[model samples]
Structures are given as structure tokens and as C-alpha cells.
Target: MTTSFPMNAGDGLYSYSKNSHLQKEIIDGAKEMMRDVIIRKLDIKTILSSSNTLHITELGCSVGPNTFSSMQHIVEALKDKYLYQDQVIDSTKSTIPEFQIFFNDQVTNDFNTLFRSLPVDRFYYASGVPGSFHGRLFPSRSIHFAHCSTAIHWLSKIPKELLDKNSPAWNKGLIDYAGASNVEIVNAYVAQFERDMEMFFNARAEEIVPGGMMVLVTPISGYIRLLRFFGSSLMDMVNEGKLDEFLVDSFNLPLYLPSPQDMTKVVEKNGLFSIERMELINIKSNLVDEVDAKTLMMSLRSAIEGVIINHFGSKIAEEACARTILKSKEISEWMKVNYEKASILFVALKRK
Candidate 1:
């Protein structure tokens, strides 16, 4: 079975903690929007009715400072809402809810580095919850607010059919469904994404309180083209006979970038949360504009090196990344044309 591995761990040079500037940019871009959503849409009174403590969970929260920054934004927004309410209503009735944040990710994530990087002057209690967010990770009606950014595109596992020799979906000489000519291969990925998303919604529906809010920021299909180039780099290695073609055939990325329509259908099928907002947000990045090979390689490696190492071993993984850096000109050209239109899907939902 294909297992989902954690991002590159530790605080080393190539670790996700050190090389996640792009993701940090995305999170920073979303902060104002998230704060607005919390102030306008979040039913703070209802959330505080049950208890004085507010429970927030960051799903797929890899090693910090991104997660730390996001949680701080949320806490500040909540406090602002409470303070604003005090000005309008009776000041004596105002109560700022205490924050308890749960930093969740796969079991293999670097929790040590994450905690070590935590701001010493943080305002909330911090705890690490290691497990898949596709399944239940908290008690029923426990979570007050949930946030996931650029992480939900990852599927729980690679589709089994892609690996079966007898299956029509057998993905030979490809690493992902993106840009695949085979309709069967695309269908296999879509099927897995639908299943995993359904499970994710079901679990979150049970965990989040009725008035709780969830904000999901995920890359849509437009982002998948970058993965195509990564696949091409591996194919180049295959042609040079440095890597086995069979290994490439068996290896596939366990990630699926869903369109807005796809996300709507699955959430509607679950029938528990109200979709408050669903829109495309353009994340500005200098890397997308210029596309320096070494910089691009480090970013991609930080996010996916663990998955590649798990499948292809460390030496081959290193070489594959090096090959990807060599093809920077090609990647840069593609980005110049297509990167301008790439936007992340941001969905805000409220438990009903």
C-alpha cells in the first residue's frame, strides 16, 4: 500500500521548516481574508456559549513558523471580534475566549522542530496531534475552528489500480495524473480524491461544533502543471538509463488538485456544512515569476523529498532533484505563460 509520508523534517538546509517560504507567502496573503471571514461570518457568541475556551485545529500543519503564524492570525481575529462586540454591547458581558490550538499532521512530521520554533510570547496553549485528518482526529463537537492551506490536495494514498498490471489505469512512465493522456489514469485519481474528501468532510463535521468555521486553501488543477515538469525530469533520468523505467511506472504522487466544482460536489454530498465562500485567490510569488532553478528545486524538494525518498531511496531522490534543477529553463518558460493564471481555491465553510 502507498503510504503518505510527512514533509521533509528538521531544521536543516533542505528541511521544510527552512524551505517553505512559498507556502509562507500563500499563508501571509490569506491572513487578511481569513481575519475578515472570522469577524463577519464566525458566530463568536454561539461558539463562546458552550465554553470559555475555543479549540482551533490546523490540519496538515507541517513544521512551523507558517502554522504558528496562521494560528496567531486566528487568535488575534477572535480577540478583535470580542473586543468589537464589547464596544457595541454591554462591556460587562464581554469575554474573550481562551485559545487551545492543535497542530495536526501525519505521524512522521517534525513536531520537535515545530515546537522549538514556536514564538515564546504566544498567547495560546499549543499541542501536537499526529494522525491523518482524512479520519477522525478529535472528539465529537470539540473543534471550534479548523484551517488547512495548500495541504488538502494530498490524497490519503495512491490509487491501487494505477499499480495493478491488469488494470487499465496502470500509469506507466508517469508520476501523476496531471497532463496524462489516459482518461483511465485521470479517473483513478479523481475517484480517490472524491473518496478521501468525503471521509474528510464526514470526520470534520463530527468534530467541529455547530457554529464552528473551516477555511481550506488548496491549489486547484492549474498548480498540477508544475508536477508535470517534475515528472519530465524523472523521465529524462529514465532515458539516460540512470534510473529504471519500471520504477517510474510504479511511482506516482499521491496528490490530487481538485477544481472548485469538484470541491462543491463532495461537500454537498456530505450535507453538513454551509459553503460560506468559495473563490480563487491568486498567491503572488517571485519564484513563479522568475523561476530560479536552484530555488525552485529546494522548494519542491522540501515539500516532496520525503515522499520520493520513501519510494525511490535517498540517492536516487537527490539525483532526480538535481536533474529537475537542470531543466529550469524549460520550467521557467512554462511558468511565464501559465503561472499568471494559476490561483488557489479558498473555501470557507460553517458547520450547520
Candidate 2:
């Protein structure tokens, strides 16, 4: 059963992209979980057919530093794997394996900063390809391995009710908890997600070699877990105003939090991949700590200053945001008094 919520939470109201430092920490955790897959199933040896050469691609890759770190780790891991087999590590970096890495995302992503963040000798090749990962980006079986972290859940773009004459099907059902049955809108979101994911796999089907491996780590949940956790009190609190206006801001931002089973079905229907490893991890988020939250909150220039303004007028939203922070004193008190934590990670993979 799909448990639905009132569409009152602010959506597309913030840019969650600037928190690269916090994102790096999450990536580190993901790397630990996925390292084995990269080595064994999606091993460069299988894709490259040579011990000394490999190709890597990071999709929806944001800044280059974290992307660079991940690639370096993969390269090192592979080098270590081959060391025992080859009896000696290559001295000449160029001779060991020419690691060609492509860090791709939207063309508008901060490529300049990403480039500056990279070290002198990081990638053999670095280029920006601007397009949705759901569509074609690279040639058939051109890249050895692909990895994407914390980025796939994004809808190509948020559905816009710009005209305001007749709202979208999804938005039609968006209502308060008192009137919480937006089946049309909810179904639309789910349908779009399914289609987009299918397209994503189809594109990957063409790009990933027959034996290539891919890992997709996103914020996900079992439908039961979602309805259980969110339905229990998350919605009630919002209805009661305990969470304020943007209460759903952090809780339900994912496009659709699919279960492990849900994802397995998605892969199965696609017919081009196989599930090798799957795990539900409690990932720390781009919001580092209490202090980090403040920075992240402030870093949301548009959320703080723009979206809120458009939604509820600038003056009122600003006042509300400020008051929300002041009222959150209880949240801080509760954190110290009680050990309250939230699980923020979901991981999955497909190997051909």
C-alpha cells in the first residue's frame, strides 16, 4: 500500500547541491559498502580484459574532489588486486593502468570549481556531458564501470504549475492532511519515476559492457517503512504544527523511496542487469552536524530568500524561518536529553 502525505511540504524549494563536504562523508560510507562489488563483480579485470588499464565513470557527479577521491580509491583498490596476481606493482603510473575517468552531470554543474578542486595528475580524461542520466550519454559498452551516489532520485525537473490555470495531475491531489487523498498526483509521481528509471537502465544497457557493473545509491525506503515511519507521527506532527510549515522539508524529499524489493523488480523488468548486492544503510547526510545544519540552512539562499518568498511572501517566510530556528531550542534540548537518530542511507547495485 502506498501511504500518501499532504503535499504541503516545500518541494523544489531548496538547492541541496552545495553541501559537497557533507556529501563527501556520505560518499565515503558508500564507498566502504560498495568497494567489494567494484573489485569482484564489476572488477576492472573483467571489463578491461587487461590488468594494467581501466575506465571509470561517475554519473550525476557534482564537484570533482569527491569524484576524484572515489576514482583514486577504485584505482588503488584495483592496483592492489592485481599486485598479488602480477607479482609486482607497476612503477610508471602511465604503464600500470591508464585510468580514464569521466565525471558527468548537468552542464550547468560547477565544472570550473570541480576542475580547480582536482589535483595536477588526477584523471587521464575529464569531460562534461550535459544530459539526463535516464537518456543516452555515452557510446555502447564504452565505459568499464559506472557509479552514482545520492543523485538518481531527482526527477528530471520538478513538475511546474507555472501557469496556475490548471495544476498538474500530481499537484491536483496535493492537499492538507485533513483532505489527504491525492491519488492522481501520487500515481503520476510514481509512474514518472518508473518510466525514468526504465529509461535510465535502457541507456545503461547500451553503455555498460555485457559484464560491466553499476552501483546506484540513493535515499530509499520500503513502502512499508515509509508509510510506517512517516505515517505514524511524522504527518500527525505536521498537522498539529509541531513541525512548522516546512516540516516535510527533510523527511520526504526523495522522489519515491522504493524498497529493496521494489528496486529488484525495477531491475528485473529492465532485463539488462542482475542484482549482486543490496543493503539498507543508515547514511549520514549532507547536513554534517548541528553546526553543519546551520550552515546548510543558511547556504540555502533560494530556500531562505526566494522559494519561501514566492510561496508565502518574503516578509512572512523570513519571519517564520527565523522563528522556527528560535523555537527549535526544544529540538536541541531533546537531542541532548534523548538519543534520537535517523537513518539516511539506502544502497543497491546491478552487475551484468
Candidate 3:
């Protein structure tokens, strides 16, 4: 039930910050959606005027830089809203409502490093909340704005049925269900997603005040086919006796890229939130033409290394990573031509 594997830490060699190119794209996509809702539709002026304090929480905030970037945007947006009508408001004098911001992720997230890298003169009072977003992490009606980017696609854990050898849904020799071609495996993934997303929405509903907004940005189903192809190459290694088939068979990433329709259903079914805006934002992969395989591999490793190390141990994890890096050129070549088609969904909802 835990989903807290964090990116490797430290500057110049971290899992996420090292892959700044991809993370920046994710931030830009999320920002575009926020502009449409937070800057335009949400009654921030009214909300600020009525409350003495505002609450904000970011889910799945990996260590440093981008997390700070997201917080800055959210804080500034609120500040700008307050200044629109109250021109005399002085931020230094505390004229606007104070902010209470919480950074949340799984229990094992790198909180020490995240805290050390905090912005020096931040306006909000910041704290860390460690828990899986699949369940509630805050008190009822406590939060005003909630944001999660490139994170929800990760499920709490791999579907249990997929691990059962006798089960029809057993996903042998595959790291992800994306483009699985098998009906049972695909159905098992869909069913698991539905359950996890329901928990996410319901939990957020309890914590977010009515009329509050939550923006979720995540890579959709498009990356699956490409990933499945790259994964096949790893299997080829096992086939040729370069690697163990047991390692490949026992590994299954706990990620499910939901379609837009699937997300809509969960939001409606939860009944505590209303969908305000939902659209796919295409993200062109720069790694294709640039041949930046290291960045690509680091990005992938950050997200899944914890799972790999947990299941196969560090030595095997290192070997698997080495093989992945060795074969990255093939993926890079395909991605260059098809990168522009990669898209992420930006969904804005209002707690109701």
C-alpha cells in the first residue's frame, strides 16, 4: 500500500533534478492548466478575502527545484489575486492571508534533502506530510488548493492478480501493462486503476474545502506503446541468456496511465468534486534529436529504481540499469521521430 520510492538524492547526480529537461516540460504543462483555472476561473479574490489563511498541498513532490517552482507559482497566483483589488496590500507587512503549505509524498521520500533545499525567502509556512495519496493525508475541509503532477499514474502497488502465476491476469515478462495486447492483463490494470483513483478522489474530497480546486497533471496512455517496445529489448536479453528471465518475469511496475474517459468517470463517481477543465497537453521529447540517452534513462530510473532494488536487490538493479542504458540508443532513435506525439493530461476539478 506504500508508493513512496523517491528519486535518488544530491546535486549533479540526483534522479529527478538530473533530468531537468523532462521535469521542466511537466511543470510547463501543469502551469498552462493552472493559468486557465487558478488565474482565470477560481474566485481567488473572494476566497482570500473571506479566509484569514490559505492552505495548499503538493502531492508527489520529488526533492527540490521543480517542487519549489510549483509552490512559487501557487503562492504568487494567490498574492496576485489579493493585490488586484486591494492595491494597498503590503506583502512584507502581512496584508494578505498567510499561507499554510504542505509537501506530501510516500513515507520514504527524501524529506531531509527537500527541507534543506527550501527557498530562502518563501512566503508560506511549509511542512512535509508523508503518506500515500491513495488515502487521505489531511484533516477534513482543511486544504484550499491541491496539486499533483506526473504522479497519479503511479498506483499504490502492482496489481496483485498480475503476480499470481495461476491468475489469467498474470503479467509475465512485462514491466508495465501498457500495450499488453492481452485482454485479461489489460482488464486487470483497468480495474486496479479504477479502485486507486476512487480512493484518491474520495480522500481529496474530504480534505479539500468545498469549491476548492485540485489540478492533476500526468502522462497519459501514449507512452505505453513506446515503453513496451523498449521493454521487449530487455526481454530479448533474457532470451539470449545475457540476463535471468526470473528477474524480468517478477518485475512489474505499479503504474497505470488512465485515459481521459477513465479519469472523468472517477471524478463523477466520487461526487465530491466537479471537473472544470480536462485536456491532453502534448510534450515533445527533446531526447530524440539530441540523443540525450543519459537524461532519459535517469528519468526512467528515478521513477522505478526503488521498485527494482526492492524486488531484485541493488546488484541486479545496477546490472539491469546498465543494460537499459546500453540499449538506450534504439529508444532514442524511435523517440526522436515520435516524441512530439507524447501527451499529458491536465485535469482541473472543484471540490463540491
Tell me, by lDDT, which candidate is best: 1
lDDT of 3 by residue, 1-352 (tens): 5656667666656366565566667787677567657866677655544677889999988786888888898888877765554564444553677888999988888888889889899999999999889998999988889999878988777788888888887777888887566789888888888999888998998998877889998888866655564367558778889778877876777788888998998888778888899998876556664357656666777667777788778776777676776766776776767667888888999887
- What does candidate 1's lDDT look like per residue over 107-144, in tens digits? 88889889888899999999999999999999999999
Report the C-alpha lDDT of model 2 over 1-352, residue by residue, as the tens digit.
Answer: 1111111112233333343444465578777767676556554445667444466778877653567777777667666655533443444333356667777776546566666667787646666665568788999778667888766655553333311325444232122111225464455556656777898899988888777777777655321121222223333445666644343322222255455666777788888888787777664444434564444333323222333344446454555455444433443443333212333344445546
The C-alpha local distance difference test score for the whole of candidate 2 amounts to 0.54
Candidate 2, after superposition: displacement of residue 286 in Å? 11
What RMSD does each model have against the real structure?
A: 1.6, 7.8, 2.8
Q: What lDDT does the true structure give each of the candidates?
A: 0.85, 0.54, 0.78
Model 1 misplaced regions, further than 4 Å: 92-94, 288-293
Q: How far is 193's C-alpha from truth in model 3 (Å)?
A: 1.1
lDDT of 3 at 255: 80
Total backbone collisions, model 3: 0
Candidate 3 deviates by what RMSD? 2.8
> Candidate 2: misplaced stretches above 4 Å?
1-18, 50-52, 84-95, 121-124, 159-184, 221-254, 284-292, 295-341, 344-351
